[model samples]
Target: MPHTKTSDGVRIAYQVRGDGPPLVLLAGQANDHHWWDDVRDDFSDVRSTVTIDYRGTGESDKPHLPYSVERFADDVVAVLDELAVHRADVYGTSMGGRVAQCLAARHTQRVRALVLGCTSPGGQHGIERSGEVRRSLIQSDPEEARQALLKLMYTPAWLAMHPGPYHTLGDRSMPAHARRGHLVASNGHDAWDALPGIVAPTLVLHGTDDLLNPVANAPLMAARIPGARLQLIQGARHAYFEECRDLASPLVLDFLDQKAPLR
Candidate 1:
């Protein structure tokens, strides 16, 4: 288990797989590196995939204090520093996308390329989940919450067709306190002004029917970031990358393979 200590003395656990150009993966709220497990193998064959447990989740230090997006971004930089990776292709999903936005804005030179999936810039301009979805996300019972999440994340047709995966996702659980901490950090993120500063070539991917973050947010981010391409997965929901990996993986791989024009 490889780990790195952030400047604040919090320890973050991470893992590396396969070989090729570095590709750092950032998971969404309440999830650790494990959230990427389903799609990791696809990228591992062509990229050196890096995944880490954000503070307050997985094996990382979970201090009983408020978490912020900037802090999460710094944690990512610390991990990169420990690994001696000056620059890498960064892929962030949902809350992770918010962290990536902060990282790109504050550490522009450290990101070679960027992928923002099912996320938002956060602010007055950002769209948010509906009350029903929000209630489901914060359910006290882990089992209930998981079921609610599954409903919000996948389309009904996909869920019916892939009953096994749906149940698997429902069985997954996270500590209540850690989930709240992640929510705090996610809610505090605001990168509307910062998006225009990201110089790295970016790809924003979203599912057309994402109930959690809403698909409208994707275009808002792409429009703000220069040279950022927006790709919408039809009929998919929040967890489209996992539910529609066959379609999502190729898009990401192709984007990462493209050479950025000399800046």
Candidate 2:
């Protein structure tokens, strides 16, 4: 594991693996690098994958403070700087996707190919989760909430067949203040204006049945980002990238491999 310090003095930890052009894997709110545990192998064959533990989660320093999506993106920039990775492809899912957007929009030259998975631009332009889904996710009991999240993320059949990284999906041990920051940062995300400004070749992927971030936003985002492509995994939900990864892995790999590696 490698570590870096942000301008704000927060310690950020990251991992780099494989042997090719670097691929930064950004996880959703409260999720660390483990979010890509299942899919990372698929990428590592053709890419050097970099996964980070966001400030409030995993091995990174957790300071109680207000958080913004842009701040999270900056943290990523710091990690990249630490690694001396001048340019690389990025794949962000859920809140990580929002972070990826700011990374591409704000630090234009750093990102080569971009993939936004199960995420939105936020603010008025983003379609939020349905009220029913909201109630389910906001349960009082932490265990109850985790169970509820499991139901919402994957289809029943997938959950029945595979007991994948469900336990590691959310960080319950994090301090209350840090968890609060995660929520506020995700809820406050607004990247509508930033979409068009992204110069990286982009791909937008979503689950048609996504309950957390609605699928409707995928096409809207693809349309807004210049020359972005949209791909929806039918009958999949929030964790479609994991659930239907066999289909998605190739799609993403093809798109990423199309570009010549930058020197």
Candidate 3:
């Protein structure tokens, strides 16, 4: 139930968990801090994980103004500043990864390490979702949208085996306007030129079977960011963090624990 006011006067709601070096968890479009609920505790043993609801989602103030990746990055910094955190490791998934790129590029000193999951640096180079997938995501019906998204998020086998999570996902729905705002912001993000500027030791995690953001983008990101490592989870899809957390968590924890060479 904690909140911070950004420079734009928007209130961003965030939660802190565990104790250790700070690790900020940035969720995908239209998702709140609750998106990290299933995996936040996984890092509690070694990290003080911070999760926040981006403006227009969750408990945060949803201002009726244009939202951009830069704005999202600034919101993150505002939360960090309010928490008295000078610097922290950052992990961003999907659209959050786009914001994370902006954060590392704009506020280099405030980020210790970077983790980009199932995301891409937008613009001409980035691949977008198919028309079918896009249609499903932007559907007016919450249940319809959730079901459509579930298909893109998980492999068919995973979805078949785990019906409970899919149902749980349906129960967590975002407002239509908020979802549209998030999609617009994500669509406008372009960090293709900024990737090379990131100095933080970076890790790009992606699922081989990711339909939303292709796995190919992962290597491109790793190659662009200096000293970045890429880890591709075979047979997994877009929501690997949720569907395959047992495998993804260790790789993330190990990378965060590794010492970054003095720059």
Q: How far is 121's C-alpha from truth in model 3 (Å)?
A: 0.4
Best prediction by TM-score: 2
lDDT string, candidate 2, 1-263, tens digits: 67999998999999998988899999988988888888889999878899898988889989976788899999999988998999989999999999999999999999999999999999999998889888987889977877888887889999999986563367766788888999999999999988999999999999998888889999999999999999889999988888898998898999898888655
lDDT of 3 by residue, 83-191 (tens): 9999999999998899999999999999999999999988988877678777777899978887777888887787888775442242145666666788799999989
Model 3: residues >4 Å from true position, as ranges? Answer: 138-142, 165-175, 260-263
Model 1: lDDT of residue 170: 21
lDDT of 1 by residue, 89-186 (tens): 89999888999999999999999999999999898989988898889877899789877878878877877887754322421355667767777889
Error in Å for residue 113 of model 3: 0.5
Q: Which stretches of candidate 2 lie over 4 Å from their true place?
A: 165-168
Q: After superposition, how far is residue 31 of candidate 2 from its true place, in Å?
A: 0.8
**What TM-score does prediction 2 earn?**
0.97
Each candidate: RMSD:
2.6, 1.2, 2.5
Candidate 1 stretches with Cα past 4 Å from truth are 138-142, 164-175, 260-263
lDDT at residue 151 of model 2 (Cα atoms): 80
True-structure Cα RMSD, model 1? 2.6
Model 2 collision count: 0
